[model samples]
Target: MSKSGYFVSFEGIDGSGKSTQARLLADHLRAMGRDVVLTREPGGSPGAEDIRKLVLEGDTDRWSPETELLLFTAARRDHLERTVNPALAAGQVVICDRFADSTRLYQGLARADLRGLVDQLHDLVIGQDPDLTVLIDMDPKIGLSRALARGDGEDRFESFGGDMQRRLRQGFLELAREFSERFVTIDGNRPVEDVFADMRDVVGARLP
Candidate 1:
């Protein structure tokens, strides 16, 4: 954790329950009397939220991998400036549903092996990362099922089908390895409470 404030980010394939876990952590912290700023990427700030609708609600082919890389990077910059930075600066715990790591895998490797460009853009703009990243690991098939069942218009990524989800899961695992110092893998195949419990434990040990 940084001296300014603890930064925790949750990541996983769609429907892996990462968002739910992030929310649970924030609630737990708040109940404990800690100020928490809970937010999500691609939509944390107003400008980023507007970008989110454009990128997530369109067809799978709505944008190329390069385009997505730019859009997501831009949104992340806005989010950091408007939502994440201030909270951390204020010594508040900032729990984010997703962060630039998502872009590293989703737009970086999963899309077209644009990982090089992804890293460059991230290093250039969004230089910071989560103090701790909780990755809810699960079978891609299971995640895809839950994601499709949601029927949310933001299913642009899920609409790619099971194969893509499997690849995404693999890529995320690889990411956890590459950035092992900050990534914690939690099994998300179990009950929601169980998953949240493990996540909380990991985060509790790390928070200042």
Candidate 2:
């Protein structure tokens, strides 16, 4: 499944700086004269963007856990086909803000028996996983506090209680353990520059 380009993903609870660090990695790679494509799951392609709104903004009262997982998979499928696979085919390093892991952490951990569904979707739709996944590990409380401080209105998942967030955090750590070879767990309590620097080093080692 190896390709000429690398696929890197950033994962973490809200406000753990996955998006910021993902952009930093992409910028750093581009500065090194590498072709880099920066994209995000749930909204990379136009069709996925439409699905994103449905997942984030639409009412959840009618949404079951399985349904939520399917919507995310649908968006991810569109994103992969439209942005990720093509960019990699052309030899571009692809750094994504979030991917299949988020669904596992947020939905699978939050909802009962949903992890299995997410896993099945990964096997059926995602097919190829990221070559490297930088997991920004942080306390759920700290992460949620930071998210609220940022003043962005709470999204569907962010609106959950502390216990749920704690479970999600644990889920991420568990995943990191289960996929140790592909996962790099970063201590996210450090300053943003330090975190980005650590990430840069990891990506640097993988470059040509």
Candidate 3:
């Protein structure tokens, strides 16, 4: 096993600009001559990508909360085994659009009672976490508008509406407080360049 690389995750409600920021960070690091692997979830590796479609498509109620968590955990396990771990072993910086934190917020916050289950499953199957998690915080209304504008086929979550997004935004902010050491909350309402500059500084300072 090798542990010579940096692992970073971008997290936020849908359309929070986290995905874009994640890509920008990867490009910036690569420009500086760093080995970087840019990926996303609920897909990253092949196996995970397959699982992603199952969970991200179809009706929002296609799977029960419990079943959804299982799919997500399985996907994450495969992602770590086939993608993230290998990248780390090869000494490459891994920048993921979303990681376990998304599960924690999306599923856990969906139903207050399921949070414990989410944490337990994570501990059992996905023990690893990103060294740095960049959370792009913004108003739910604005975020949802942006998310809907994208017209991404994966609207299962985006269709949850503004009220749900509000809950998610709050959940993410609370997570930031709980995981202060490894979490950085960036205001996503700002210009993309400003957000990227802040993200670059955050990741650059901690790059290994």
Candidate 4:
């Protein structure tokens, strides 16, 4: 890593196992005696977690997409200020389960017109990108099945339905292409061990 902290984020459609991989990577790096800070958004910080409940819970129609975008951006700003930025300044490796890209795919590309707003908000408020983003690619059918099985009440985004999931998958893939230098697309349909091994390889090669 540089003088600053190394930032890595895991991304994928719901239940694609990016969260699991993020945890595993954090563990692996810690075993290697590296300083690591594992976090997630839009709830990594105290203020953000409160916002998380507002945005993630409630009826699917609780907030319009635009309102939801604003909530996410607000949470992200708090997360960056209270968690990510300080950790990076201290030179620790920060592994996050999701970041701005999730908002881009979920709220932005899900509707064509919203993309411009997402980009503008990102550039204006949340101006940083992860040094590395591990995109776990998987079939929407399988991913949705896994997500539904989790039974977590935080299913507002998941409630967007199958058509939305397919679009999310495509949106994430497009992001990998658009930011190829920072993205590593991993096949998430495989066994957990296989996925972790691939993630380990990518992360190891990039560690300072």
Order the candidate numbers by lDDT, best to worst.
1, 4, 3, 2
Q: Write the per-residue lDDT of candidate 3 for residues 1-208, one digit (tens) a residue.
A: 4499889999999889999999999889899999999999998989999998998888877888888889999999999999999999899999999999889978877644588899999998888899999999988899999888987788888876888899998999999999999999998899999999998998899887
Q: How do all models score by TM-score?
A: 0.97, 0.93, 0.97, 0.97
- Please give the TM-score that candidate 4 achieves against the real structure: 0.97
Prediction-by-prediction clash tally: 0, 0, 0, 1
lDDT against the true structure, each candidate: 0.91, 0.83, 0.90, 0.91
Ranking of all predicted structures according to TM-score, beginning with the best and ending with the worst: 1, 3, 4, 2
Query: For residues 55-98, could you state the per-residue lDDT of candidate 2 as single tens digits?
Result: 77534454777788889899999898889988888888999988
Global fold similarity of model 2 (TM-score)? 0.93
Flag clash pairs in model 1: none
User: lDDT by residue for model 4 over 15-49, one digit each (tens)?
Assistant: 89999999999899999999999999889999999
Worst 10 residues of 2 by lDDT: 151-160
What is the Å distance of residue 6 in model 1 from its true position? 1.0
lDDT of 1 at 200: 83
For candidate 1, write residues 38-142 as lDDT tens digits. Answer: 999888999999999989987899999999999999999999989999899899999999898899889988889999999999889988998999999989999
Off by over 4 Å in 3: none
Residue pairs clashing in model 2 are none
Residue pairs in collision within model 3: none
Number of colliding residue pairs in model 1: 0
**RMSD in order of candidates:** 1.3, 1.7, 1.0, 1.5
Please give the range of 10 consecutive residues that has the lowest summed lDDT in model 4: 105-114
